[model samples]
Target: MIAKSNEARCTSCHAGYGWKGNDFDFTDQTGVDCLVCHEQTGTYKKFPAGAGNPAPREMVFPGNGKTYHPPDWNKVAQSVGRPTRNNCGTCHFFGGGGDGVKHGDLDSSLMKPNKMLDVHMGTDGQNFDCVRCHSTTLHNIAGRVYTTPAYEHRKSLIEDDLASKITCESCHSSSPHKEDAKANDHTDKVACQSCHVPRFARVNPTKMWWDWSQAGKKKNGKPYKVKGELERPEYDTLKGDMKWAKDVVPEYYWYNGSIEHLTVKDVIDPGKDVVINRPVGDKDDIHSRIFPFKVHRGKQPYDKVNKTLVVPHLFPKGPADADAYWKTFDWGKAIAFGMDYTGLPYSGEYDFVETSYVFPITHMVAPKDNVVACKECHAHEGGRLAKLTGFYMPGRDNFRALDTLGWIVVIGALLGVVLHGLGRVFTANGRKEQ
Candidate 1:
């Protein structure tokens, strides 16, 4: 299943490159095709089932007595040029099965976004591409995932000089707010994206919840699907129950540029929702800063005897393969096949366990004017930063002694001014009468 998933699903994005086996051979010269991204003519095509190889010229359409011919490869290769937004977005925009399914901030709407949606990538503005921030050197991309940030300069100083640098501070210094001192002061405690990206999935909705436990449910012995809000599939026989949301307000948390990922071998507590991937940080850590995140929750299969999460082989190798879960809807056979591939023991007993993963919100940056207002985070009630601890905010937090001292000074100054005004008026009247 792992081999099929990687070769079939994963290879769809890099269809121009060639792969001989399940494992990607980095040493193989034919595996990396430069024209996939650089091809501007859009003539290059890949065979979806051929493990990243080009489609055959005389491919026959299944069940249709029709023939399809791909473009000339030599001519397509000659027209190769620099990559564009469409070339890079081909895979990223449609990640996690569909558009806006995985990352809330990235989607097909960014292809020609307006300035209001994203200042940097907007066609009316800077019109920057993914490479602007995620610069590459010899095919090594600079930026890192939110789970494992490599460019957080304030946290965990990287000792490797060869490592790529792509933090917001790399272009805009740590003190970016030159005009507003108050805004600059918050930079130490808050991330630039926390305020800049007010909300995500503005143009489209993103999947927030998935329930594999509800899978294999059939209505009248046939696989069925139900649509929910926005006409999205709420349930499917192939996948499972899902919940999607749009214009989502991100959950805030502190991050120190590190994360802990739960592997297949790790034991989990069935009593609680397992954190598949968690960012490492704390409020007291000086290197940590408040960043926005999208928390994706789901329920997946777990082994009762092994006390670990199980990896089920869902795809079938052939039409008659009984071990495939999608084909047979038999959890026992699927789990056994997966466990055997991993060389791990699996108990027949299995149950769905709650799990969650966090993805940091770093894209969909709105213009400067669209940033969060000061009152949004500092309000006395229902403030965005109210849940955050280890710091004192003047309007949000109150100290009895400090409040009393401030009131006394204000009252004393007012009383002195009133008395001086009265005395001056009385002396002026007396001088006029004399």
Candidate 2:
């Protein structure tokens, strides 16, 4: 037992990374002693790093240890403090491009112990914890050799399955750019960020940190910041309540064209008179927009059934006026579905598939720069926009267009008097000539 005290536990007990282990034998105490890991010169030489920390109980951890007693478990747990990315970053983060740590994040600042609160909202907003989006469950976030899908939602099935990427999809709405496409020709994703964001840029839910040293120096050193501006999206005010993060990137949009509905058109020929070159088929992909999906606090792998975040009236700003809105009308839209309508005569090579059936490409428009009210889209009167046609004269916005019409009518009446006088002069001259 005395000799065991000198030697520490083997790799197995250390849990490889000092987290927890399956066969943890504190008694085995292999490899190195507690003093070594604790940074002590000898037995009983350890003290807490911070000033004024009370001297720890003069005992060693029990169970596997050969000597000494463990600290009061409850006292330690209470003082454990909030978890932070720093704990993970100590080993995971590397900016200078060395030691297999390349998430391509342009940040070099080291993580701080209690800084989580500053990065994300506290346990009162929709997003309570910062770790909800940054880290993973079951520990040590897993990633492939060539990491892809910079964020979880945009990640493909090729990287992580639908489940692992669920968090990404939830926050970033997955619906069509438009809500009810059949009613209002909403095109690409309206959340906007989904479209306009540079391929892999993401916001830091933890802390907004960047590496001044490596930021400007490109891989080839030709002024890396010279890269074109990262197109950030802009979000509209929520029912005149609040605005979203100013840095969000929206989609690239432009009017493709117009169509009443998205469906397939039928083509007909009688008695095989027309040599059928193309086959007719089906378009089955159909999507819909059900706004305000349920969102709870936390990050990746969001549990849909039961969970919620702490949303305050305001803190970073002030307590929220009311509880968090929780759901979002943004990012809700429909998609096209496809199907096979034609029964082909042959099996494989000669099998016919429909080319005409598609989500009428004519209706798919891109997001444009200039924003106009939905009413402005149609110029028809008695429509939503036309009904807005009221007095629209700009006089400190004091006068309406209809107001100007009233003034014009009054001036016309006065002009009639002068015209009558001129007519009398002409009539008198005509009588003299007679």
Candidate 3:
């Protein structure tokens, strides 16, 4: 999707200033906007379409209708401090267009959460900042996306000197439950987030489904928007049909930290569901554990002849642009432009193909009282872990032969006990006569 986006629109949240093209210098430390992360002043704002530049003068952005004011350089410089929740949330909460859009576990609600919402980030509870877990070294933050391994070895801070402090195991050791050995034992097979964070999008609704095939529908002369069940725009002329949900029960998967992704040029089967990325592990893998994920399903364009996914130019450069899907609403022109930009060949004929992308749920740490109960995943029917097979869960799995043998053993033991008691009673009379 980065290929479909304009740098001006996409890089405002991530890339520092003047990163409009490939020629942008990556080694220049001066270009790095330290104020964006370190400034204590809440006034520091990046222009939405400024390609990582702040507003030169006071002006409103035409895209989002938000007014931007040039920061007072002296005031901001004096207020330089460690990054706060607001500093990190400024970019992360707004990723993928708006708040709670990209990541269901992260949103503006976390900024001032209560203990019930998040035990760590809650202002009324532990009140831990983002840096508390995501320790930084030379500005290379500790956390990595699920597509890559965050830690080579899983160990607590006291266990190893080289272990990453980002993992939950780093702080809360492998055996965190003090009294419950059963729960502590489950840690080996289940991820901490899988049980600790039972559901995601607990506070705000997140987009669960998107259909790009339904895009380009416009009202007479101008593009229009329609609100859906969540009171948010479900159908947009630019994007398409979207379905939103809150308090979402996450889909479970066996993840070993690393993942495999489908590249833009990779061949895909049009008949099957195109997985954007998949976790790389199985039940047998030693490092793998049952992790929770928010699966976002969608339908997007793919070349029928080339048998590859096509990236459409989605953001418009300006009002006069014709190829961008936002402005022109022409899939052919947008796909052609985006493909040319990426130096990939695209067949003239294109059709929509189903796709699925997953985001790991790692945030929204609930209190101990709110943790998922044992029966949620260990019950005989409709369990959270019903889809997971090959493992013999104590209460959930049953074998007919094993049950029959167990019952026979119990019956034989009871019969032997009764016969021994009867024999002892019969011998009591003879012993008295002797």
Top of the candidates by TM-score: 3
TM-score per candidate, chains pooled: 0.81, 0.22, 0.90
Q: How far is 5's C-alpha from truth in model 3 (Å)? A: 4.9
**Candidate 2 residue lDDT tens string, 186-289:** 32222222222221112321111121112112235332122112221111121111111212121122111111221122232222222211111112212211
Ordered by TM-score, highest first, the candidates read 3, 1, 2
402 in model 2: Cα distance from truth in Å? 49
lDDT of each: 0.77, 0.25, 0.86
Q: Which parts of model 3 are misplaced by more than 4 Å?
A: 3-5, 25-31, 400-434
Point out the worst 10-residue segment of candidate 1 by lDDT.
Answer: 154-163
Position 78, candidate 2: lDDT: 45
- Tens digits of lDDT, candidate 1, 38-145: 787776655544455556776753312355467687788788876777777766777765777778888888989998888888999899887877778978677666
Q: Backbone clashes per model, in order?
A: 0, 64, 0
> Would you list the rank order by lDDT, best first?
3, 1, 2
Residue 304 in candidate 1 has what lDDT?
A: 82
Looking at candidate 2, what is the lDDT of residue 286? 23
Q: What's the distance in Å from true for residue 29, model 3?
A: 5.6
Residue 235: error of model 2 in Å?
A: 41
